[model samples]
Target: MNQKAPEVHPSSEWVQRIFDRISGRYDLLNDCLSLGIHRLWKRAAIRALGPVQGKHILDAATGTGDLAIRLAKVGAQVTGVDFSGNMLIRARSRAPASLGVQFVQADVLKLPFKDHHFDSTVVSFGVRNFEDPKRGIEELWRVTRPGGRLVILEFGGWMSFKGFTQWMARSARLLGADPEAYAHLIESSCSFPSGVGFVRRFLENLAEVKTQSSRKIFFGVAHLYVLNK
Candidate 1:
């Protein structure tokens, strides 16, 4: 018996709706699905950013504000942005007032901000969600000031990808998660470029695009790349 594979949405609107529907359980699912290792991965990405005392940072696609909160703690003025309103609401509600982490609803493909506005930009497990990843990376560098850093943490795509991301969706489904949402998720990750290939594309329109550091985590399931603009 042959079963049809699940379909992933092509529209960004469908993606937003999926995130909104699962925004409440997003954080818990992160802890459960990744077995809390995501926190460690995120920390490693921040560490790659080096010192951040008084630096202005942007956390793109910052769902629930986990990475944004961490960036704020390191003395960086952080602005976390996402297009999903429900995700922003959760990020705002969970973020401590004293942290002063600003949560805004915005699309990554076309950010609404002046050029070179941030000292550095960080996206943790988020860049893959952008409808246009190359544009999103360019936009990240656009807001980043000269000598600024861009740190991206995402799932690696150069490995055996068949059924892996789909298997992830199945696991999440067993826990009462949205299979349709994760089917899209798996599809996106499989389609997203990472590490070296992504670096070449990310540096296409930038000057002095330098990689400060690179790391592979969990046996190359994820990668951390820090670029200087």
Candidate 2:
């Protein structure tokens, strides 16, 4: 395994402000940047858990409710939670009136749910943003029922991925996004825990655990992590 990278620091206030500023355009940028493969990546995460019908699923850090919506479409009652009010507002506006999905405002590290409350929990592209990914994972494990699943979709920084994202960041910076934000995007991956490391933590927090990892696009730039407890 790769040696743990030096811990990187990202202020909570800065992260919140950055997302707030980009809330309206977040979905657009995601689709444009990932070439719409993000949706498929999310679907892959959903599929890893087998079926979710009639199960209670929690989409933590569920900006814009994409994964939560997808889960609901599969007959799971989904609750989407995020700390950003503006992002939740956009998610609520686009959500169907009959999807049985509810959007809530809450921090991922300090979720307001009790143990064994959720049958499944999913966080899309949100884990890397956490100030403490381990604690966040533990929280997800805390709320999940025994034998349930936890899925995480986030960017990873392999050697090849580092090179490609470097160029993309330069392009994105030229397009008027705060250069520092793009810089943070590149650096955050290094700070993020890998699939194996995260799985180990989840197993420590929950019951039985399994993990799988898959890459996306050039240079293996993105990673989808599926873990069952």
Candidate 3:
């Protein structure tokens, strides 16, 4: 008999434990599984986020501080927040004192900062891990100053890439990727709405925000969203 896939509960505590367990190898798995293309995607997202020099920015669900490091390198004062202490420890080890990135242990749904505190906010491959994705987004909006932007990079199911996605998902383990983790990721991506569906939901929860969908990456295996408040 075929075995049922394990349920993926993206509660904050559950997600924290998952990252804590995978923290050591998380970066490697990301590099391998995406065939090292995530770097390009991340770079693209950062560029589209506009200038951040001398500004305050938040990198929520900042696993291992890759995005945080990039933001700091560009002269932004970056606060990278993650619930997993282990993940933050790895991030701290990799981050130099000169990098100017602050790694904090905090829940994304209830950010410790005051409202309208950040000049910009960004999350890559992180929002879907939220137990309440909408609430997670609302918190982002709460902290971003007026006229600031929110940028996100996430897995997407593009119509033309249906067959390609299937093939790629099958090829994941061939790259020595984490099979169980990728399984949950693929399931979550497919179930998460994108395009118009995503826009409508975002508009509902966030007031006075403008949104634009960017070109999908690798045939929509991932998507970029820019929301300006």
Among these predictions, the greatest TM-score belongs to 1
TM-score of every candidate relative to the true structure: 0.89, 0.84, 0.87
Error of 1 at 167 (Å): 5.2
* lDDT tens per residue, model 2, 74-190: 899999998888889999988898997999898888999998799988888788777677788789888988788887777655522666667667666656665555556566765
| lDDT for 73 (candidate 1) | 88
lDDT of every predicted structure (CA atoms): 0.80, 0.74, 0.81
| Deviating ranges (above 4 Å) for candidate 2 | 1-7, 159-163, 195-219
The collision pairs in model 3 are: none
Q: Regarding lDDT, does 2 or 3 come out ahead? A: 3
Question: lDDT, candidate 1, residue 17?
Answer: 82
What's model 1's overall lDDT? 0.80
Q: Per-residue CA lDDT of candidate 3, range 35-106, in tens? A: 798898889889978999999999999989998998899899999999999999999999999987899899
Ranking by TM-score: 1, 3, 2
Judged by whole-model lDDT over C-alpha atoms, candidate 2 comes out at: 0.74
Clashing pairs in 2: none
